[model samples]
Target: MIPDLSHDRIDRLRDAFRAAGYDADGVVELLGPEAHVALGRGEPVPALRATTDAGPLGTLVRLFLLGQAEPQAAVEAALAPLPLTDAQAAGIVVADGDRLRAGLDVRPHGVGDDSWWVVSDLDSDLRGGRPVEPDHVLGVGHASLSLVRATSRRPVGSVLDLGTGCGVQALHASTHAQRITATDVSKRALALAEATFRLNEIDVELTEGEWFDPVRGRRFDMVVCNPPFVVGPPRTDFTYRDSGLAGDDASALVVRQLPAFLNEGGTGQLLASWVHREGEDWEDRVSRWLPPGAGVDAWFVQRDVADPALYVGTWLRDAGYDLRSPQGVQKAGEWLDWFEDNGVVGIGFGFVTLRRTDAARGEVVCEDLRHAFDDPLGPESDQWLRRVDWLRANASAEGLLAARLVTADSTVLEQVSEPGDEGWSPLVHRLHRTDGPGWQHEVDELGVRLLAGCRGALPLGELLELLAMGFGEDAEELTRAAVPVVRELVRHGMLVPAEWAGGAQ
Candidate 1:
């Protein structure tokens, strides 16, 4: 049942939570370090034992976080101004004789300095430690954190959070956007999001519809979505992950439809999973999702790829299915069979960033970087898009030679040598980027000297000429050989235009 979120009740509830100090630090202090760590691993026994003392904070934690029934007097004491009857009326708790049990999961979620509480359906870990319900509304999870960290948080006039399950993304967007709209296909999810916003005292416009249907004619400066991009056969049960659409279609639809909803210079970021077909490259398959000549720029980073068996097992375990059980094995085999029949070679999971630009044609940059990186990649992502645009504008050899370049502060040049009979001779030269997704590229000796000479004061052509004189080679020939490598460096942010060294270009 959805909570009745009246203004007065919300105010009282906030006061109650604040009075009890039911926040991230407070919970950790009450549960201690071991219980907190155990809870993170989905083991709630330690937490339950830690909260056995019927204190106000402990009572609330047991009722909500541990999904345990607490005595009526304890619940009433925990929420002093907000009565237990009001909690029942709001559908957040149910009366179990002399005890009260939470109807939903409410927990403290904090990022940086911003802290707030999230409300959603009880997960499998809290509810008997088994598979979750079909229409479960997820609270804060890794996917939610990934989208939050991946999104570019530049201050914008308007922002949209699509498929906002419990409004975690919208909550984060509220920190930067002036006007925020959060939409979901499920009314229940929307209700929980409303409760979340009310708890946080944030004003976000809530809409209910599938994908872009809620805001058909409006455009936003930023649109962030963590939709149901999981690829598989039709499954109507899992609303949070399965979209019922056949095989990666949901992710494709989101990518294809982003251009129309974005304002010029606006950005759309999302987390998606795409299939790797046998005959086509995964990058090529994802690049085709952007329309030709749409004036949008796209950057896709594949973070993880898995075979069919691993993919099936991973998601099954996510849903709390024990893989060694008979039912779990049967379900896993069926999913694997489905993948085999559908010609799915592998599944790639990653972040996709699309920006509407003023260019005459669209540009797509696709890369497979299956590793982890530092969080809050917004600034880096925005810089990457600008770098790509700069490279595209200066693609020719003459244009590059005429442009002033600088080695990015995050770049490092490494020379690797092998010890042989003839002594240590350079075998490989690599340029590595320590920021964003952390890319590495192998370069030749000439390439290394050229990049080293890019100190933002000299034009690239002049640097190449000096290098040619030092090596007794033809300047024109060296420039021709180095142009493509320089372009690649610029595109990957190992090199940057002098104009963009300090500010936006």
Candidate 2:
């Protein structure tokens, strides 16, 4: 636990920031990523490597990212363009000490709805989890967001959050559900979650249990379980990392039994793991878990595929132990042996979402796509709001794509091509076309050209025509190409409908 924040100190820090020529917002961004560096390393992080424009403040920001403690000497050496006041420096020093000791980084921005995060033993090493030390920023990897949204598909009468480490999903679900029953096995984890709710004054039913045992038969309208999905053999110290289950199959088992614990018409939102074996399809492995005739929209996205050695070695290091340790080496070999015995070629990680449609019917849809971590889906708890709205309004993919997308500030267009392809493959811009939908876009060269011009009101057809002239492609052909691209963007939230206030799925 960390010390309580003193308003006087915060005020002092605020004044210091102002004195150093930073407005409230600027200081927040400066502090967000740098704070992590400040904790991770003892020295101040340096400024931008490729650019010279960041100035002294930027240098200080880098110093902070390196986990530097009061780079006072570095500051003096660099002779910052805008110097910091002593009070500002002192307050930062105090704050830095507080954060470093706790192994936490409180981002200065976007902290709504269970925003506080501790770099997990797994996250710090594996390079996963919340981005920018805050809540889920909107329009991150939308597939994971899709998995997250699927959890909210239920009526949300009452929700249960299992393994609520930082309480990210729990806090978001709180607004939709009448009440939340959150459970975790770790006392440290529970306490951290308790502190978060207490600070925010959000109420949730808290309990200490190994999986469902604590809340057994205590049914909920929706059950959200983001368990330790890393598939490995048990460790001596049970943590947020290892579930102590035997293999990847454990997560599937949790999904299998989860329905029994949910209210009729309730949905079970599961971020799960399964074995990608030699003779078995990973999707088939999950299908065996769904109850007969259960209405399940199972989207199992194998975002990553790792073999036995790579898979076991990755997790073995997560427990603060390395394969170099003789015992560690032996334990790692056990995991390797287990995968080999099962004829598993690789492991699959993704979601198993089940919605109870009707007592007599069940369905499962397994989708495999490559996606990344969502670093910015914050405060948008009701994703279905825009999704359902777009569905109602557009009525078709073509219509949806025809809708205009408004990209926001600090957004970028990320183009990923299929491996071994010659053609300039489809490009998806990671832009905030609108709230509720912030994924990727079908950006033909013209769309990119149009995107460069999409700062204001411009007809989609006209944009395509402009691109057609530039690329020497037929304007109608370009428009046709962009239509499907636009629809896909809208469907995947790369281009959200206008007026979407951005809710979680």
Q: Which candidate is the best by lDDT?
A: 1
Q: Which lDDT values do the candidates have, in the order given?
A: 0.87, 0.54
Residue 413, model 1: Cα distance from true site in angstroms: 2.3
How does candidate 2 score on lDDT?
0.54
Clashes of each: 0, 39
lDDT of 1 by residue, 355-452 (tens): 99988876788988876677456776887887877777886777889999988888898899999999999999998888777889999898888878
**RMSD, every candidate, angstroms:** 2.2, 12.2
- My TM-score estimates for the predictions, one after another, are 0.94, 0.55
Candidate 1: which stretches are off by over 4 Å? 29-35, 43-54, 95-98, 324-330, 502-505
lDDT of 2 by residue, 348-401 (tens): 776555555442434354656455544332223234333434554665645644
- After best superposition, candidate 2 residue 420: deviation in angstroms? 24
The top-ranked prediction according to TM-score is: 1
